[model samples]
Target: MYVYDEYDQRIIEDRVKQYRDQTRRYLAGELSEEEFRPLRLQNGLYVQRYAPMLRVCVPYGLMSSRQLRKMAHIARQYDKGYAHISTRQNVQFNWPALEEVPDILAELAEVQMHAIQTSGNCIRNVTTDQFAGVAPDEVIDPRPWCEIVRQWATFHPEFAYLPRKFKIAINGAQSDRAAIEVHDIGLEPVQNAAGELGFRVLVGGGLGRTPIVGAFINEYLPWQHLLTYLEAILRVYNRYGRRDNKYKARIKILVKALTPAVFAEKVNAEWAHLKDGPSTLTVDEVHRVADHFVDPAYQALQDQSALLAEQQAEHPGFARWMARNVNGHKKPGYAAVTLSLKATGYAPGDITDKQLDAVAELADRFSFGEVRSSHEQNLILADVEQTQLLALWNELRELGFATPNIGLLTDIICCPGGDFCSLANAKSIPVAEAIQRRFDDLDYLFDLGDIDLNISGCMNACGHHHVGHIGILGVDKKGEEFYQVSLGGSASRDASLGQILGPSFAQDDMPDVISKIINVFVEQRHADERFIDTFRRIGMAPFKERVYAANH
Candidate 1:
């Protein structure tokens, strides 16, 4: 919830005007498609399969109710009546007219938002946990550091056009909800034995054609040198990262080619020049950035477990939702709630303008006028009072937001495949819908327990298929759509890429294939074992055998 200063506001306004002119020239035929490609990409406009898609940045996934309302307005006025939340916590309008994108950005700027750095081969949006400040087990609030990094990365002259797109993630909580292991740079805040704060830095982590769990480069990088160290890493990558081939241009490939030790050595050598330079963070500046995220006025209250238990007894449906959607809060009587966007038959992350407006109202009523977007393509109200849980649940249920499937099989994380993305080999939305229909029984999904089923249209891995407990990727063979399955991948603290399960299957067989995988998991699992735990305990052999036995 960082508010823009006068200077920030001016920069956004100026960029909007520049883009407006750029758009006018492009539409008037003064600029060809070749000439306009980079310019349009820098502003988050992509010419997709059917139309132009505009990706609007939601930095660190934070948005005010006012900002949410403006986004709803843009969706209603400028494009289709809906928008899709991406895996990086950004929002995408898949049907924006090429000429009208500037107007959409101009509207966004009025609410202190923009599409800057949402796309192209530059440092994209800095992301973190959806429950950054409010998580009960947090070691530090990451939003301040994320904002500091965002400011430093925005339009940094040297990194404006890297060898490839770059992503960074920061996690300050005990758990790794931010998926730090799968980003170009992952920072975890930690305190030393001497009681000084610093970060555990990981580098060379990414997911694409070549998926990797990042390697640890520094055990404890001091707090003051965060930006300086980052600059050092970028300097090394920009100098040595491949430009000949886009596939191998990412820092991960460079790190692999040089080995992590040599990569660290290069970064260390580069850091020697800039460690104490002007880019180093100061205590006052840190406080200045942090001031924007000051805690809300919270009333003192005892725990509401007894009252919640009574409500659970009164309403079974509410009880199921409470179990799935509600999370423990740092405050005594407050909780964080996830509003499920995966209503059956709809796209996993698609939200209509009407639902957006309703969510804005709900945020104001229960969460201090702020809302959060999660990497799992769900919306979060991070500071709802526990006493008002029943009322909030009732309202969300009426809005079709209470599906009680936060981490279950039905709560799928999928990308808009061939439907919107030109890069996709097959349509992911229909695949997700088919799976949802197959597993519609709430009892069945809850029985499956804490499964992350991610589907990506192609190997770009927009849906993060590499890290799902059950990962599904679409493939094109002989110009026909087919699905590939993988198992045991995770994006948590113990991160690992999934292992593929033999050959691809026809699209029509996807539902039964998933059911077969689940059947194997159920047969082999120990008591109370989650899908991931069972998969890990008993490798991929059993699941692979069961999945491909008849076909072979």
Candidate 2:
């Protein structure tokens, strides 16, 4: 919830004005498609499979109720009546007229929002845990650091266009909810034995055609040197990273080729030149950024466990939702509530304009006038009182967001595959829907427990299929779409990439394929084990055999 200063306001306003002229030129044929490509991409406008898609940046996934209403208005007036929340926690309008994009951005500017750095080969949104400040297990509130990094990276002239799109993630919690290891730069705030706070920096982590967990480049980078160190890394990448091949241009590829130690040495040598430079963050500035994220006025109320228990006994549905969607908060008597977007029938992350408006109102009433969008494509009211849980649950149910399937088999992470993305080989939305329908049994789904089933339309890994407990990637087979399955991947503290499970299956056969895999886990699991735990315990052979036995 960082408020925009005069500098920030002036920057986006000017950017909007510049982009408006650029758009006008393109429409008037003064700028050809080739000429306008980088211009449009710099502003987060993409010419997708069908129409132009506009990705609006939501810094660290934080949105004020006012900003949320503005987005609803944009969706209603300029584009389609809905928006999609991407895995990166940015908002995408799937159907926007190319001519109206400038207008959309101008509207976004009014609310301290923009699309800059959201696309193109530049530093993207600096994401952190959606529950950054409120999580019980938090070692530090990462929002301030994320904001600091965001301020530094935004419009940085040097990194304006890297070899490929760059992403950075920060995690300050014990749980690694931010999936820091899967980003180009992952910053984990660690407290040393000497009581000083610094970041354990990881580099070369990505999940595209080549998936690799980030390596620890700097075991402990001091807080003061954060910007200078990042500058050093980017400088190295910009200098030697592959410019010949787009496929081999990412920092990860460079890191792999040079080896992490050599990369670290290069970064260290680069940092030697820039250490304690002007951009080095001061304690005062850290506090200045930190001031923006002060906690809400929390009441000194007792825990509502008894009241919730009574309600749970009365309504099993409420109990189910409480078990799945509600999360622990640092403060007593309060909890964070996730409104499910994976409600079986709709696209995984799609939220209608009406729902956006309603969520804004709900955030105002329940969560201190702010809402957080999670990487899982769900909206969160991060400070809801436990006493008001039932009321919130009832409203979410009416809105069709009270699906008790968080962390269950039905809570799928799916990309807008061939349906929207031109890069996609197969359709992911229908495949996700099919799997959701197949796993409709709530009791059965709960038994399956904490299974991350991610589906990507292609290997760009927008769906992060590489990190899912059950990963599904769409591949092209002789002009037809086939789904490839992978298992044992996780993006948690113990991060690892999944291994593929033999051959690809036709779209129609996906549901049966997933069912067989689940059956193997169900048969092999020990008491109280989750799908991931079972898969790790027994390995992939049993599941692979079950899935492909008939063909064999």
Candidate 3:
């Protein structure tokens, strides 16, 4: 919840003005398509298959109720009456008119939001755990560091155009909800024996045509050198990363070719020039940024466990939802809630304008006038009072937000595949919907337990399929769409890329394919084991056999 200072406000407003002129120039034919391509990309506008798509950055997935209302209004007025939340915790408007994009950007700027650096071959949004400050297992709140990095990277001239898009993630909690290892740069806070703070940095981890978990480039980078070290890493990538081939341009590919040790050495050598530079972090700056993320006011109250238990016992539906959607909180009388967006029939992550407005109202009514977008394609009420859980669930249920399937198989993570994105080889939304419908049984899903089912339209991995417990990727076979499935992947504390199960299957076979995989897990799982754990222990043989065998 970092408030925009006067300087921040001025920069955003100025960018809006600049983009407005660029859009105008392109439309008037003063700029050719080739000339306008990078300019539009730099501003987060993409000309998709059907219409222009606009990606608006939601920094670290945090949004005020006021800002949420602004988004809802923009969705209703300028584009289609809906918006999609991305796996990176950003928002996308799929049907915005090309001419009105600048108007959309202007509206976003008024709310201290923008599409800057959201697209293009530059640093994108810095994402983290949705429950960053409030998670009970947090070592330290990462929002400050995320904000610091965001400030440094936004409009940095040195890295305006890299070989490819760069992503950075930070995780402060014991659980790695941010999927840090899959990012170009992953920063994990650590403390030495003296309890002094620092970071454990991972580099060159990414998923596309090739998937690799990041290697530890720096075991312990001092907290004071955070910015300088990041700069060093980027400088090395900017200089040596491939620029000729877009497919091989990512930093991960460069890291793999040079080997991790050599890459680390390069980064270290680069850091030697930047060590103790003016951009180095200071205790005062850390405190200033962190103050914006401090705990909100709370009245003295006891835990409502007894009351919730009684409510759960009375209503089986509520009990099911409570078990799946509710999460632990640092505050005694409060809990974080995940409003599941993966209901049957709807595309995963799609929120209608009315639903967005309702969520804003609900956040103000229940959560402390703030809302969070989860990396799992769900909205979060991060600081809801335990006393109001029942009331909140009822309202959410009415709004089709309480699906009772968070962390379940039906709670899928998916991208707007061929339906919206021209880059997609196949349709992702329908595949996600098909699977959700096939597994609508709440009891069955709960029994399956915590399955991260992610689907990507293509290898770009926008859906983060590489890290899902069950990852589905869409591919084209002679102009026809086929789906490839993977297993044993996780995006949490034990980050690992999923292994491909077997040959790709037709779109219609996806549901049955997924079902067979689940059946194998059910038959082989030990007591209290999740789908991912069972896969890890048993390997991919069982899943492959079950999915591809002649008959069950």
Candidate 4:
């Protein structure tokens, strides 16, 4: 993980002090709710349905054991004793008192963390693959670039108040685990024919009331031109993005109205002047950032673990856990393990303070004192030794974090819908819970095989419903809650938005609808084909036909 430099430290401390003063003024009636709104939002505080929620950034989803422990402390002392991991790989506390948020941020500052840019109509947290440095297929680690962008975007005067919230994601692996296609800006590091490093830049992609995959803006931007090229994109958005209507303010809308080609042309015209500016990244600065993320010191060991193999043979539950939770690591004897938060009857990404502390301790004991939050809202210890797998599992089991459903049906991705979010047309968490209850059998989930069931409260797609194999979107029909279904959406390298099935269903009918869709996939799929592959091969007609047959 990258350590904060003096500049980084100074800026965060200043921001914290600024927010603390702003908070005091708001409490003293010097600032009204409307006046304090933007200030609080800039600090990542949101007034929710029941209470205020604070989202803390976990830069590029990397946290030290020490940082994790601090977060656990914050959760315990300031807010409710639990935190929800968001789809953007940030941790959100749902019960923070509005008055105590400044104090919480001050504490976070001590650990080189904060909630800045986690919300508001500005550039939000920059996300990348959680397995950045460790992935086998990576051409180069993307964390350095992510950090660079983080610094540039933080409190950027030009982009501080954009037309709407903008998100940027970077991916370095062959797989699109970061969901680059659905971000305002997506950067994929690519090597040219001559083996020089660069990025494939995509723009105008987003998921919301309107979902659009990003279009290719630049095929290859050299390493040195990253900042310049990014500035160009933001400049274009800031100048022409709609300001009249909140609903039409996103850059995606501008891109759609103008067409991607004209959008690129506008950005190119802006880049003509700023291409060689001082902010452009240089080799030395790149090295300075990259050096912070060098691999942890790894001990040499045998290629395979005899004890693990023996244990797997003895215990089926442990065997199943190892199959789903453990990932291949670049190191010989180490594995990356996911501590699933999707246990039955619980919210998908909710982890209590005690569980967070336990995970921090476990990371220090078995891994390299590092923890990662996945985009799927799971916790990962990236360097656990093969020999320690069973012991770690035991500890995690005690903490209620050892659910072996990483890619299973029960491992759902859901947004904090009507229960918390003011924008939601209906509640999504209850719907997710209902579906999980209907399909609680682990064997059945495993047999279903790598199904992605995502639910969003509305079209904002915070839950990533568009890319789910079975996407569920909440809709409003004459002020009543309803759900619309989509099939075959995927967020991998061959990314595609899902197709709608038909008429929306009432909230009570969601589980049955989902079950019917799954049954059709089970019945229609050829042997050895995944749900996505099956959907692609046969199209959505069969599932759509089956779902609305009675209505038709």
Candidate 5:
């Protein structure tokens, strides 16, 4: 993890002091609620349904064990002893007191962390692949670029107040784990035919009321020109992005209105001026940033064949977990473990203080004192030894974080819906829980295979329901809760927005409806095909026909 320098420290301290003063003025009656709104939001403090929610940024989803422990401490001391891992790979505390947020920011500053840019219409946290440096298929680590962009975008004067929130994601791996295609700006680190480092830039992709996959703006932008290119893109968006209506204010709207070609043309025109600007990255600076993300020292160990065979023989659950939750790592003996938060009864991304501490301890003990937060809202121990797999699973199981449901039907991605979010039409957590309960069988879920079940309380797509293989959107029908289903959505390399199934189903009918959808896929899929592949092959007609056939 990158250590904060004096400049970084000073900036956060100053921001904290400023927010503290702002809070005091609001409390003293000098600032009205309306007047104080943007000030608090800029600091990542939100007045939620019952209390204030503080979203703390975990830069590029990387955190030290000590930082994770501090987060656990914060959850214990201030909030409800738990934090919700957001879809953007940030940690959100739902019960932080509004007055104490500045204090919280100060504490976060101590750990080189802050809530800055976690919210507001400005550029938000820059996300990259969770397994950025460690992924086997990576051409270049994306964290350095993510960090560079993070600093550049933070409190940027030109874009401090955009018409809507801007998100940028970078992916360096062969697999698009960062969901780059759905971001306002997406960068995929690539190597040219000559083997030079560069990025494949994509723009105008976003998910919300109007979901659109980003289109390629540049096939190859040399790594040195990253910041310049980014500035150019932002300049175009700032100038022309919609401001009259919040719903259409995002860069995606602008991209849609202008088309990618015109958008790219405008960006290129802007870039001509910025091509050699101060913000243009230098080779030395890139290496300096990249140094912080270098692979940790690992012991020289061969593959643990005996240990794997033992795990397969002794523990079926561990075997299943290894199959679903473990990812290939760059190192020989190391594996990236996804500690699934989607247990049968728990909220999708909720982790208690105890669980957080356990994860921190596990990272320190088994991994390299580093942890990652996946965009799927799961905690990752990125460098665990294969020999310790069963033991790790046991510890995680005791803490309710060992669900063997990654990428399965039961592995649901959900938002803080009506239960906590004021914008939600219905509670999404309960819906996720209901569905999980309906599909608790491990064998059955494995049979269903690589299904992405995502739910959003509203059209904001906070839960990324638009890209789930089975997307569920909560709707209000005649003042009653209902769910609208979509199929064929995926957030991988072959990104595609889901198409909605027919009429919405009532809350009570949701579980059966989901089951029917799954059954249709199972009935129609070719041998060994995943839900997404099957849906793409057959389209939504088969699933839609089966799901709504009885009603029609």
Candidate 6:
């Protein structure tokens, strides 16, 4: 929601011009593939298996309805008729022509959007909780801080190329919906015993070939030193992170090698040089950025619990949807609705141009002309009035947006695996579809309760399979695709990497594999326990036994 000033506009426009020239040079053979690789990546263009993919950043997952319409236009005009929402809350067009990416970037610039830092080994798009300002349990609005970081990191010369990609996440709420511990840098607002506002910083947490939860590098970093401290962390990583091996180039590997204590000490020494630097945050600047994210015009109204109860009794289907898809809001008589994108038979997160346009209209009508992209690959209307919930539900259902499976077993988080991504060794979309079809019964899913079933085509962890309650990773066995399953992983406050069950299974066996795992949970779970809690209580032994027993 932060409007671009003249400086911001000029910079984006200039970059678009520069990339257009670069693209022209490459297409004309003035630049070879080797030379154009980094340039194209820097601009968020990737030459995938069949065609080029363009990833457009949605900073902090917030998009005005106008911006949404622009994105839909791009999807319709430039490439395929649909786009995929990424796990990081960005959007990806999988079939864009390589020659037309600059035009697309220029179009994005018109709406204060760009693909900068969406790829490349620079700080990627800064992310936060989708319900940042409206969450009842929010301690502070993180959008301001996220925006500040986005501006600072965009095309920063000092960190243009790091050893590998860097990610930063901020959580300002009691719940850790932002998956802070899995990021390269995680910032959580905390208050000292003296009641001073500051951040609790975590460093070097990541999921890939090697998964590690971040260590607390600083117990408390003052608000004024946020930028300065961040600079120090990046400086240390840039100087010491490995470059000899791409697999081990991430900051997490460096942190592990140096030991967390030594890494913390090194960062502190680096911070000594940056302390009181010009990059130090000022109270005025923080206030200025925060002002842009203030609450919209909200009408005063009583809570609509009685009316909602009546509607629920009247329409059981709507009641089921309301129970799963609707979330509590900080404002009275309002709700945050998650429009499920994981419908059966469709790839999770894939939204057509028509769907995007309709969503934009819905956002204008109900959500203060803004929409949010959730990390779970769903669209959010964060300010829907409770009085209009029934009407909105009906409209969404008609548009194929109301699956009523948010947080259920069927609301899977997945990536465009082998179908689009060359890095993927196996297909992810079909696996997700198979599982969704097998578990289509609404009553059965509700009984299963809040299970995060995430799938990744490969170990890059784009699907965040490492954090799912039931994690599935694709493996290539003798040039054939096999699926490996894991359990007990979570991305919440109690973050932990999933443990593998056993050997991999053929693609066709995934559904049965998942069914066995679920059977174990249902048999062993205590009253009111979710899949994650049951996994933690009983460990992976029972589930492993059930899955492997069938294979044997």
lDDT of 1 by residue, 440-520 (tens): 999888888999999999999998999999999999999999999999899999799999988999999999999999999
Error of 5 at 43 (Å): 0.3
Residue 396 error, candidate 1, Å: 0.8
Which candidate would rank higher by lDDT, 1 or 3?
Answer: 1
Across 307-424, the per-residue lDDT of candidate 4 in tens digits comes to: 8889999989899999899988777888889999888788888888888888888888987899999889899998888888888888888888888989888889999999888888
Residue 114 in candidate 2, Cα distance off native in Å: 0.7
User: In candidate 5, how many Å is residue 55 off?
Assistant: 0.6
Task: Give the per-residue Cα lDDT of candidate 1 at 167.
Answer: 99
Error of 2 at 172 (Å): 0.8
What TM-score quantifies how close candidate 4 is to the native fold?
0.97
lDDT at 98, model 6: 90
lDDT of each: 0.94, 0.93, 0.92, 0.89, 0.90, 0.94
Tell me the lDDT of candidate 5.
Answer: 0.90
Q: Each model's TM-score? A: 0.99, 0.99, 0.99, 0.97, 0.98, 0.99
How would you encode candidate 2's per-residue C-alpha lDDT over 11-125 as one tens digit per residue?
Answer: 9999999999998998899999899999999999998999989999999999999999999999999877999999999999999999999889999999999999899999999
Query: In model 2, which runs have C-alpha deviations exceeding 4 angstroms?
Result: none
Best by lDDT: 1
Cα deviation at 514, candidate 6, in Å, is: 0.5
**Residues forming the 10-long window of minimal summed lDDT in candidate 3:** 543-552
Candidates 2 and 3 compared: the better one by TM-score is 2
Model with the higher lDDT, candidate 5 or 6 = 6
Model 3 scores a C-alpha lDDT of 0.92
lDDT per residue, candidate 5, 488-531, as tens digits?
89999969999998898888899999999888888888998998
Superposition error at 245 for model 3 (Å):
0.8
